[model samples]
Target: MNKLRLLVDSVWRLTWESREAAHCEELFVPFNPWRESDLCMPSLAGYLENAEPGSSFKLNLSPGKYLPQYQTDKKYEFALESFASGTRPPHVGRFYPKYLLMGYFGNPTPFRCIDRQGGKFTADFNHPLAGRFLTLEVMVREIKQKRDEKGGECLDWLDILTSGPGIEARYQGLPTDFFEDDPFHREDEGDDRAFFAQPRLVSHVDTQAQAIMAALYSRLLKPGLAVLDLMSSWQSHLPHGLELGSLVGLGMNAAELQHNPQLTSHLIHDLNTDPDLPFADGQFDAVICNLSVEYLVRPFEVFAEAARVLRPGGLFIHTFSHRWFPPKVVKIWTELHEFERIGLVLEYFLRSGAFGNLKTFSSRGWPRPRADRYYPRMRFADPVYAVWGEKLA
Candidate 1:
């Protein structure tokens, strides 16, 4: 199986094993829309910031474990446990479902004090972050890379540590185009549904392009860091058998993404429409944008957002191919030829002014033989190109 799917399966098992036996009680995990909600969920620790005023989801929980219980219905209940906040007195007298909506519900279960102790009680079936706006800072802790117990090799785990803010390195005043003609920046002109109409699970680039992607992942991706596959498709083309904390995919089509077992979880979004990412800043150790840079019109704005969200010294990698549909490709790209596309992506990063220590690399392969007799959409040669930049503090 792919790395992302493997991680999800392993994590799901671990979550199950960790919280299998406990007194079951109804719990609230608020779905916070604002605050540090851009980072990927299911990986972040703790209950997230509270949801908006009317948003709430239910989970049946057992004590000492985070995953909610979904099996049998057993009743051996005790009295209610009124929540007490640190540095604040017990508010049992004023405890209403509405108060929880307005107040900061810290890890109410872990290290929380109760008015009447020693008895297990089900608090009101209210959401934890009912009325309050929470400011949550995300941190990715240990990513386990499990290996075989024997002398044989096994999955390697990567424990990501937050070493303060990311490193800040300055660029050496490189002359770059603040605005370049993008070859693939056209707005969808046809019917609204037609724009996102087809779920093309096909890889835009040929085998050469895919091989380059695998090699790139192998060389740049460490064994245990959380990896974000931005502008992702059905296939991440990540190298096989690599250990990763999490391999999250962010793409537009649900069906295409669902088929990808590698994605532990995926967010369906169109960057062309919504430039702001739904992830917390510095949430991932690395972000991979593969074969999709050509389609971005607001490249700088997107890059800036990526830089803002990335940890200092976090890596942002982009790979592109000299292939695109004429109608879908931007005016600029249609105007330029193949080799210049690489120059264009570099200009994109430089123009963003958010990336430091930018570097470029080329994969060596025989260019596809150009077809003398051509059908309209059939191309003869495959193009390969890639570029990378590091986020500065």
Candidate 2:
């Protein structure tokens, strides 16, 4: 008899107040329906209860159905008496630790700096998704049975979902500081030649994150299509055994791209120095950049160039995580909330004016692989964030 059954559900959300464009987000999570009661949210418990191995469906969730505790409060939207301690100077559209306040100053709750005047900062302590609507799309990836549940903490999917996902949408569609103070500036402005002189041959994200990335790529990619692994490394993160027409890797370190076994061919190039791609227009079916979008100093130019190189309807994708060489990441990347980073990437797609069907995807809460080095330091795998759009025909 079946016991614990595995399932994955995705969430879609969009909100626009003053901004003409809608902020879109898609998030996914895998869970055991039988073991975690709270995770099997009441809205879809019956649907999951009857789900079979390949079941799939979508649900339109009300604003506060899953999580109503996030009631809006006028007090949560005012200016603080003084700039809090143990944090950097406040900036509008940025999130800071809530515990820095006099009351819960010890808590790490997220407090967004919605407005900043000449000498004071207006903070909003409301949950990022406090009043926004959401749509939950579920796909049952697997439904294998296991031993009986021995009993454990009932996980709350909504809490995990809301903890840090909805911040991607801007406040009242107001633009964050994406272009202010030199967004592309980095701490390490040294030569790329010296920074990548050696082949590190390491995975930026952990094994679980790698697995999720491979799975995501597997679904988006198909056989017999030329693909470019831009900003490539030794690990392309493509699914093993997946066949493609041709796979070319373009990166700075020759040694690292050379070691990539899946690449049919590889080239050495530094996109930061030259945003223009060497490939001809409409040469490849797809282009993918992983774990390194934060390093693009000339992202706007590079994204437009990517659009030029793709065939009509070709897709461009970028994936990233929280971890990176701190010195090399763009200045704005470190400033926004984790989810807000998606908004920045989405902006790149929008500004290019060369792509459409824009969307962002993310998945979190998977158990961190115990064998991995960061196992003890983090309880879950590095959350995966992705943004992709197809070249306008």
Candidate 3:
């Protein structure tokens, strides 16, 4: 019997939202294509039979293979106790446990909440991937012989990737209500300058996650583009040896920006204090904000300013993970589903009206580097989420 290890990249869609990419890597996959028809889907076995270490291939899973295409029904709608902020009620386009809505054992599957009225909240029981076409890019991490031909569980990588409340879902079937209280409000109403006064030279995400973010930047950032690293800290996660025309860091802490090795020049400017960028229009080819977008109180103003600074065809990219300081992040950000957070950022681009070709990405289930401090506690690396679009000119 053969055993395989794979990282599955699933490109899924939601109406009007950009395509969502989810990457899941598995340590062990039993490979008896004929006997394990249930391993992935029937269509996946053919690819596994020939897969090998370091090989990657893409395939399309027919619609309805996930759950069924979304169906219109009454069971989805339910009433809410109240819309109070303290109660933490469910809102539209987020997910909740199946049991939470129905009052019984949910078996751990998450259901998308599609709507919330004055008193009721509707839950979409359909798999978030339902009706959405699934395009998978599989990379065979390792393939080896199972020393013994013994029975084992058929761990579906797709389920592991998309399962539980971990996955983010559709932006909204209808207009989503933010909340009764202000979402832009943060736990600490103190001036941001005061909060960021001290230079915290620590990595927000783990080292492996940092490498992934830099890899992402390397792909989107052309070699000679003038890139702006907005709200940057001590370290700009640009690839080690990239040649750029100029790298500018704009942030609150002067010392932090000054310490970033990637920045050609750095400025201590708080977008919260002054939403406008201090640059001529069309000056930069691209702008990037990393791990710090959630803290922006004036995101719309900042986005408009970013667009104004970018050249006609320039790109604006924002990458973030699930970590944030509770007292500093915008209140709504804390409430967003990890994927819905992508939609939240995507909205920033759409509202700009200056960008197109928008897309979102999420990578999960990668092995955490053993060297990282959290490696002992967390199984996989911290999931990385990014949203980006290019200016229309």
Q: Highest TM-score: which candidate?
A: 3
Candidate 2 matches the true fold with a TM-score of 0.81
lDDT-sorted candidate list, best first: 2, 3, 1
Residue 128, model 2, lDDT: 73
Model 2 segments beyond 4 Å from truth? Answer: 1-58, 68-81, 85-89, 100-104, 117-121, 137-154
lDDT scores of the candidates, listed in order:
0.50, 0.76, 0.70
lDDT of 2 at 145: 59
Q: Deviation in angstroms for 120 in model 1?
A: 84
- Over 185-303, each residue of candidate 1 has an lDDT whose tens digit, in order, gives 46554532356557887777766557667877798888888778888878887888777888889887777888876777898878777789888878888888987787776777788
lDDT of 3 by residue, 255-351 (tens): 8887788899988888887998999999999999999999998888999999999998898988898889989999889876676677678767776
**Which candidate achieves the best lDDT against the true structure?**
2
Clashes in candidate 2: how many?
Answer: 1
Ranking by TM-score: 3, 2, 1
What does each candidate score in C-alpha RMSD? 25.3, 4.2, 4.2
Model 2, CA-based lDDT: 0.76
Task: Give me the runs in candidate 3 sitting further than 4 Å from their true place.
Answer: 1-37, 82-90, 102-108, 115-118, 144-154, 164-175
